[model samples]
Target: MFYAVSAVVLGFLLDLALGDPHWLPHPVRLIGWLIARLEQLIRPVLPKTPRGELLGGILLTLIVVGLSGGVSWCMLHFAAVYLGKLPAYLLEVVMCYQLIAVRSLKAESMRVYRELQKGDLASARIAVSMIVGRDTEKLSPAGVAKAAVETVAENTSDGVAAPLFYLLIGGAPLGFCYKAINTLDSMIGYRNEQYLSFGKFAAKLDDAVNFIPARLCALLMIAAAFFTGLDGPGAFRIWKCDRKNHKSPNSAQTEAACAGALGVQLAGNAFYGGVLFEKPTIGDARRMVIPNDIRLANRLMVVTSLLSLAAFSLMKLLIIFLLH
Candidate 1:
């Protein structure tokens, strides 16, 4: 129990100090490779029907998640048995560090922010495109900034808090399982004609796993808004009124809180693959979103990450105490 808690704290600090380096071999990337390969193999074998594709997707999900969790657990068990507790704990620390992505998210968004600061609209659009799913070829400066801010807000739940929550509940093995699920969704969970049926299970499972964590992250972000001198009450009000503004059941929670905290409107129609997606706006148009809001959003995200770590750690400790 002590090692589990210690590893999570150390892993978070490690992520903060050294973000993800491109040179490093990330487990998420490996999981993504596994997912892609499985998709190829499964798609060829499955019948070209909705039900057949759905079955293939479900099987792929189970294999990836089970293998991820099983492999991580086995590695830890072997390290403890052969090497020592210290070696096992170190391994867990690295795995946990790999799971959470707050620092990398900030770094990626800041690329857009920096490009915008230089008045380089084209480069800013390119930078924003790297982090978001929307088409960025013709975005205005404000649109670029809004996209950066929105990704930061949405990922405050997806990239940071959700992984931390899973780590608290079941350590790195479970965290890897969560990451596998997320990777599968990001790779194939699209509503496009090609993936509509095949990706249904991945999309639905991602939503199921993220449901509680997303709302919890939003509430924590509201508290972070209060502590950071943002519009805390307004965050709550807008979250209550607009958290369901997105098509996804969970994507809007943090975005609504963030839009309210920054006093701006976000998420009103966007282009993807040259197709227009008419998304409802979340929050009031109290002000136009600016590039500096990217920095502010990063601030809120970091504060929310810290708060979730503390809260989850304490909960794990309480559970351990109760069990004893």
Candidate 2:
């Protein structure tokens, strides 16, 4: 357990030192390939009955989970044996931490802000498009800001907190497996006609897995806002009142809290793949979203990350002391 925790810490530090490199093999990508292969193998065996399909989905999910766990275990165990203790420890930590992308999220988000700052609406739209799933072709400056801010808030949970939570609970192998499941859901989990039935399991499983982490992330962000001298109460109110606005039950919770904390309204109508989605507005209509809000969101995200780390460390220490 100590080794597992140490590996997660080291993996995080390594990821901070070295972001994802194009030259090396990415574990997430490898896991994605495994999922693809499993899907192919199971497709032909899918039963005609709903019960059969449900059973098949469960079996498929288990296969994915098993393969992911197996690979992570092999890599971590091999590193521990062949690499020096410190190096192996660091490698494990780096691997675990790399799964969280708070820094890259901030960077990408800030780039959109910078583009908007230069009055480059087109460039800003392009930058925002890279981070969000919505259409950016006709977005105004404020629209771009809102989209970027919302993405930052929602991903703060999906891309960062969720992975860390899994690590704290079960260490690197489980953490990596959680990420694999998440990535698979992101790729295949859709409500569109094509994926509605076929991707049902992936979508539901992702929702179930993310349920706790999303709320925890919202609380973390709220705490972070308070620490940063933002209006925590405002965030809480918005979260409670407007969390139901978005189509995604969990995602809206965090994004609404963030919008309220930042004192900006977010969500209206957005297009995705030419389909329009109308969402209720979150936050009070007090302030217009500007480029500075993106900067503020980034700052809040940094605080949230630090707070989560501190909390994790303290919990680990308490566990060790109790065991001893």
Candidate 3:
């Protein structure tokens, strides 16, 4: 138990120090490859009928989630049984570090912030484009900042806290399992005409899995805001008032909190695939989003990460003490 908590803590630090090194082979990428191959093999065989699409989608999710979790568990079990405890702990650290995206998320968003700082709208657009799914080519400087802030806010749940929560409850296998589900949703989980039916299962599953973590992360951010000298009460108020403004069941929870904390309005409108989406505005437009908000957003995220780590570790220790 000590080693488990230690590994979780160390993994977070390592991810901060070395955020998603391109050279390191990532399990999410491997799972993505498998998803593409399986979808190709199975999607072609399944009929194009709605019933067939639904059945095929279910089969696809089951195969991906089951095989991914099973394989990861078997690997970890083999390491623990055959290798020494120290080696197993090291493996856990590496796996956990790979799954969490604390530094990478901030790093990518900061790129947009830095570009915005340079007053280079085109470059800022490009940088924000890398982190966001919406169209960035037509975005203004404020639009770029809002997109960066929004990504940092929403992904506080999806990219970091969700994986960490699963790691605390289970371990690397469960963490990576959660990552697989998130990756699936990121890749094929769309509501477009092509994927509306075929991707419904993965999208819905991702929503279900993210439900609790999204809310938890919102509260964490609110607490973080209080500690970091941000607007905590305003965060809570806006969160309660506007958390459901977005169409997604979970994405807006943290975004609303972040918007209120930073005194910025977010999610007004955006283009995706050449179509402009008139999203409901979150939070009152007390102030326009500035480049510094990105820095503030990243600060809030790190504080939340550290607080969650401390909280989860203490809980694990308490459980260990009680069980003994």
Question: How close is each model in CA RMSD to the real structure?
Answer: 0.7, 2.4, 1.2
| Tens digit of per-residue lDDT, candidate 1, span 199-288 | 999999999999999999999999999999999998999999999999899999999999999999999999999989898999999788
Clashes in each model (backbone N, CA, C under 3 Å)? 0, 10, 0
List the global CA lDDT of all models: 0.94, 0.80, 0.89
Local accuracy of candidate 2 as per-residue lDDT tens digits, 68-183: 87777787788878886776666667678668777678889999999999999999999999999888999989999999998888888888778877887777777877887787
Error of 1 at 110 (Å): 0.7
Clashes of 1: 0
Q: Rank the candidates by lDDT, best first.
A: 1, 3, 2
Model 1 weakest lDDT span, ten residues long: 1-10
lDDT of 1 at 2: 71
TM-score-best of 1 and 3: 1
Where model 2 places Cα greater than 4 Å from the true spot, the runs are 22-24, 36-60, 81-84
Report the error of model 3 at residue 16, Å: 1.2
TM-score of each: 0.99, 0.89, 0.97
Off by over 4 Å in 3: none
